[model samples]
Target chain A: MFQPHADRIAKPLLAAAALVCAAVLVLIIAVIISGAWPALISQDLVVFITDASWYPLEGQFGMLSMLLASLLVMMIAILLAAPMGIICAIFIAYIAPVRVQKIYRFAIALLAGMPSVVLGLWGLTVLVPLVNKWSPPGLSLLLAGIVLAVMILPTVALTSLAAFKSLPIALQQAASALGVRQHVQILKVFIPAASAAILSGMLLAMARALGETMVVLMVAGNVVQFPSGLMEPVRTLTANIALEMAYATDQHRAALFVSGLLLTAMVLVMMSFAARIKGHNDYG
Target chain B: MAEHLFQFVIWCVALLVLMVLLWLVYGLLDHGLAKLSFEFLLSEPQNAGRDGGIISILVATLLILAVTLLAALPLGLASAVWLAEFTATHHFWARKVRLALDVMAGVPSIVFGLFGYAFFGIFMGMGFSVLSGGLTLACMILPVFIRTCEIGLRGVNNSWRQGAAALGMPKIKAVWYILLPAAMPAISAGLILGIGRATAETAALMFTSGYVDRMPESVMDSGRALSVHIYDLSMNVTGGDAAAQASALLLLMIIIVLNMLAYAVTDLWLGRRLSNDLA
Candidate 1:
């Protein structure tokens, strides 16, 4: 129970709490810069962009390939997730009976709530080994993409469900009344209207894939160098930081922070789009 | 004929997507099928990382959730109280603060990890400590706290507020004695979600808390959470393949149960409130 006094003091308390959030941001940025200043100032950002070498002891910290590896993962994962998630939403919203829809929603709720670690373990045992056997070098970018796709499916599915459900129920009924098949009604009416939510969900799913750390750390093979095609082992910024931060020091550690900063920058941009989509959806 | 072609393509895509989702669930079952042992979950990490246990991790997961709740509840509830009961809508700074909190909701966990490592681990000298990780998680999920509480408070009927005011009750007293009670159900679910998020969180904890594979006796003890522990034992033991599989099975079951508990608790609590209103 919150028992606030009827006084200016209560006002000060709120101001103070808000101030704490800013203070946290400031403190975090300061510490990262100070700790990682060596790498930030000494190592050229170009190396991070162009070079493929990432051996920290030798000071070769190029991450262009790793960056691409991450991008490739996000790209493939979204490809795998968005359409299915959209269809799943359609099934739940239009095709399924009420009982099935309830079950689908509950399943989604569980999926959303499941820890990433479990997903990582599943990926490591099932996805990684299967890829390793069929694909060359097995633990390649494609493997990471597939695992990440599953990892983020619930996010995309649930948000798209929200999107499809947000449409006026009459719209679907009207489409059905016009002799449109269930499938046609989905694309012509449901998908278009729900596009914004679907798009935002896709972005959030991509964001989840891009920012995932431990799962990628485990299954992405921890190779910091470039991918030799789709089957080549590679690294991601989140994985790079997670794998090395254990014993990293000086320049090595700061570079990890730089990676973290890069991830946050990307996420901030991604989240703004999420907010914009959410905002536009809210107003609608 | 044109509709048929488009439908063909769409159905092909839909069926492909459906198979992929089923494939995902099958993977979950495949990894976790054999290792659902109560004893394995109750014991500690042992036997050279494999065939040991997940008890330490289970303890750490709950411990982090507890610490996060302790750290966040006071601050979040305080902020919620201000915005809902005390502050004027015309207050520019108050609106800005809420907006900032909303934006904070979007900052990625990686940034929180960096900040946790720097501010709490280094600056605060809570180096690689559980408290640091918990506090970092608290900050990360605070927006959920505020937003949920706002909903709960708003759900309290306006007549309650007016009635309290007419009775010559103090604003602060009214907030505590009347409104919070009515809103308790909604607010409690928010706390549940925050705890769920905290328990499952890893990246933020990865840096601020070192992964000591032992039970934390206090908030300051550095330790690996269940998720981090699962990541470590499974990934770190790739060279010894069998042991990794043993732990993965154990890890998956624990995660399912934990997720279910978190979700059910929130749902039941909220649902009960809604039901009571109907009668």
Candidate 2:
């Protein structure tokens, strides 16, 4: 039934079609670098990246503060989300009734699907104000981190759930055979066994939190200063890029591209690291 | 005592997430849903989106969705078919393609926005039009489409393929006529989820589609999307919070409906297969 000529054509055609994703990846990096070249070449790359000031009018484009804010806020977000996510995963995987488990799963999926902008709007209107009542200005690092924590919760929870669900049946049986109580088995046996997967989930969520734009953009206050406290407003690398890209010109445009490059590189590193550390027992 | 304490902590943590979820949904409905009306849905914004409605922005959002699906569908399906059917699971190029897709998925939306602005808007001379935003969005959602279509194609049973082969059917014909139809539901389910994603995206569209309030006369016209509309109102417009909240309610309702539809479709598909097995 196969035509020889058609076979030759189809194979190449399909291969070329499949290559589009790879091609697009290459194009994105190349385009971004080329766009950023004007700034990268003229300015001292080290000083431009290391200095804390970001005066675009005078062309003082240091991203040190924003970078620090991005890392600091991401760390804060992961700290808040990871424990909750892991515990939530534990509840869903082992404790919840089957019917409750189904509902929780659906709820988490719906939560994940909720747009970031809407969440940002909520953060701006509700969370920021709430934080402000206690902490003077509400749109600060703390508010951004809290919003991010909420945003990335489902990512961590879902991954941790998959990780726990894949725990070997024998391990649970062994713990039970040894006459361990349910809580003890979970703490000593299940948690220890699922730790690698839990760590993997944390890392993935860290990557997501780091890359998340809208929620933090709306609530993070977009100040390019070093965050001395969680109550102080901070600008993230992502917020910096998004806030400036539209009106940025000449050196400013290139500087934004440079930050874009940095953001892309940071995310890719986290992804690769997550991929590397991912537990093999997942999907087992 | 230690075990009880730990259990309490775990329960509290779990309940926290559930509480947050409920609070968000309930708060949006209470604060924003009251403001929503059919007039609000069908009219254009007045006073920088602080008042009136969101009909134009909704149309722009739908237009972007159309262009995104148009650009994404054929290429995504073809690649998914390639990954699922033609190549070894661990083939070098196949793995590379998969890796690229994974990396692409992780890249921040803002980066895509920059790329869209530089490549499509400036270099390609589209200049923040719906066409540019749509193409960028197409790229952004491509991984979702490919991954979903791949799963659907893989779900087509191996026995069916063997049966077709035994009947001396060409591989292409079998895939086209049998596998494609069998996987259509799952593929469409993926599309629904992708729609949720595309609808929610804001950063990527901010630069690629300039936030003009009017209905796009052509794909080349710049326009605001629902998410972008909400962002603009929240940031720039005074007393825009009310309008933003109202738009948020509509956006949330739309997303929840899409997700529910996706769940229902997948469930229905599985239920049908189970019943057929019993028969």
Candidate 3:
């Protein structure tokens, strides 16, 4: 008798706790939108996309250079990380011995677990100096891209490993029976089978690179410019907010929120795209 | 010859990945370990961290972590229970919850800092306290904690539930006694991972916590997190690199230990389960 009543209370309580997640999401969107309302209404959207100057105090809220910088840095990161990470995953899944594979996986986890700030610290002290020898200024899009690549490599490798592990063993066996070479089988059969999951992983990594703050702030040199080359300094949308948020007020503050809103939208769009791919994979 | 060349390239790539990890670890240890000492761990900063130790920063980090876990753990566990037990997998509400979690998980830490500043600092008026920082971290990490715990709970055998129902066990009672105990390893693993993340965080806590290096009097007091301290010491303070290295080493050790603990918990649990099954 008492147990039934307890169950009734407990079930609803648990559900209410679960509903808090959905509520939090709604609240986040509401808060960001409201914070950004002033700038959103004040400025034309084209100004954000077309104009490159970002002098917030003088009332010019152009973010085009930073926007392009964010995308370019992410592109550099993806271009460098994707092939290397996928190859690492292939080596682990198909080539490495069992003991070696386990160790490699653990190393990858340790890499993933390293704080972003620490990576930034390394980039600041070590990588930046190393790049300075050739580039004159150590902090640039190329250096940031390298740091970001290291940060996201584990994500790509881990996801691709899962993708490979999930393939039907018979597929490999049939390929071998047909006398297909190992490289040929990997290049043709296994990669094609796992492309969707691998693509999703790369997409997630790109989102992470775009949203990354401390690393870029430390190593990207914080110059708000359209980079003409890989070694040129540039600021991302994230770094802009972190750098300016402390003293920004009024329209300046609102503009930071606008940047935040743009970042949130970009990350959400990429996440949803990745989720859709994963969902399609699950069903099809 | 081609196969050999391909194998050589793969081997080189694998070695390169290993070298990166070693290089990072070596870099930190080489620069940091010489500076680390008992006194360094237990003292407070002086002259803007050019001298003295990180005891106050350590306290603030722990207090913030405590507040975060205190808030996030119960909510995360309850939500996981609800998702794994009460809701059907394909239910509309369940899908929405999962979607919300995915969105939350993908959100950048800096945005959480902005949200925390706007919501907790300004609107709610918590204002740069440990409580505000911890709550922001709780929000950021809740999705991760929930997903891990839910996966653990869902991995429980279906027959365990059926058997409980057959034995006339109350749903709550079975979940409390059986399902939770059975899922303890995963739950503990998830908890450790959450703790690791909360400890290593910098951006999300920067504004909400408001970077006061003094020892916090209470949750309401502003406290500087270790990550924030490292960032400031490395970037802002001239000649603060030695102290920053020491602090980074300490933070790195804490995260590595927590991660190892997570792995150990899962492995121990798996070993026990195997032995019991054989018996």
Query: How well does each candidate superpose onto the true structure, as a TM-score?
Result: 0.87, 0.96, 0.97
Model 1 C-alpha lDDT per residue in residues B112-212, reported as the tens digit of each score: 88788878888789988789888899888888888888778876767789999888777767878998887886687687678767777777888877688
**Candidate 2 clashes between residue pairs 3 or more apart in a chain or in different chains:** none
Query: Which parts of model 1 are misplaced by more than 4 Å?
Result: A1-7, A43-47, A173-182, A280-284, B1-38, B88-91, B238-279
- The pairs that clash in candidate 3 are none
lDDT per residue (tens digit) for residues B1-279 in model 3: 878788888889889988988898888898889889999989889999879999999999999999999999999999999989877787788788888888898989899999999999999999999999999999988999998899888777777899997898878888999999998998999999999889988989888998899989999999999999999998899999888888988888988899889889989878856664665
Kindly indicate the candidate among 1 and 3 with the higher TM-score: 3
In lDDT terms, how accurate is model 3?
Answer: 0.89
Cα lDDT tens digits for candidate 1, A232-274: 7778888887778878887888887877776766776887797
lDDT of each: 0.73, 0.87, 0.89
Off by over 4 Å in 3: A1-3, A280-284, B269-279
For residue B229, give model 1's deviation from the true position in Å: 1.5
Please tell me which model should have the higher DockQ, number 1 or number 3.
3
